[model samples]
Target: MTTAVISDSSSLIMVGKLKRLDLLANLFQQIVIPHRVATEIQAKEDGVASLILAHPLVSIAATTRHELLALLDGTLGHGEAEAIALADEHQMILLVDEKKARKAAKNMGLKIIGLLGVLLLNHRRTHITGQDAILMLEQVKAMGFRVSARLESDFMTRLHNPITHWHSPNTLK
Candidate 1:
């Protein structure tokens, strides 16, 4: 896969779960964060920012005014806007979780995926086991990330095997 530039909120959420970061860093060629996103993270004084900065696969890039405005006009919120802008300017995939922002990105023909999507991809790639994927999802939830019931169900189905009962919703739940 090509490099993906994540905006602040998603990166913070991802890095907060160290295991998720380990998986992502291994999956992608590179992970870039806009300078604005980095600045926001730096202000938090949490390990997320430091971890991202220190990661060999991750880097920061400054965003321009034009790109910022375009993002603002897009469906992205302030933080996500900067991320999308950076991704668009660099022709990289934008890793975002906001609904409106995702819709806007799709409208603009930009490749986008949310936190759940990333986790699912990791699970599919065998970077994380099905159980670990569920654990990561729970961790993100504890950190205040939202996951819709439908999305959760869909992901669980992907992790299930038709010939076995290991991942049946009743058993997993």
Candidate 2:
């Protein structure tokens, strides 16, 4: 089974925009969003807020490590810092999309996943077909997810070569 996931704002926003929050719901046992991340997403007029609010497995977690958060305050967004701190406290995996935040979380020794990673997970689990996965990836990328050219190309290449790429989704790191 996949590890527990704590999501930041970007992952929520991206998957919410894709209307595929169900993917996260199915991919992980539970998903915890940090309080600051929830606050940042609360005002958004996207499907993510409603889905997060209504989902039974999704909950908001407050970060108590003020010093850790303060240290990361300037380097990362409030939501990202709180999410990272919360994940660190609980020893859960992080689901973040921002490049800098992802790098920081990794530097802190946290296992990380991103929006595209979740999609790929679904595909690996046979929850979605390769074609469907590719289509969803294209949709998210087109919606301004800021995927690097090499990563985009890699996903496409992997999707087409299942024999070699049929590894665990956690390899997304």
Per-residue lDDT of 63 in model 1: 65
lDDT of 2 at 13: 80
For 1-41, candidate 1 gives per-residue lDDT tens digits of: 54555555664556554545766664578877777677777
Where does model 2 exceed 4 Å of error?
163-173
Whole-model Cα lDDT of every candidate shown, in order: 0.66, 0.80
What's every prediction's RMSD, in angstroms? 6.2, 2.5
What lDDT does model 2 reach?
A: 0.80
Models 1 onward score TM values of 0.81, 0.89
Q: Write out the backbone clash pairs for model 2.
A: none
Error of 1 at 83 (Å): 1.2
The best candidate by TM-score is: 2
| Candidate 2, residue 25: lDDT | 78
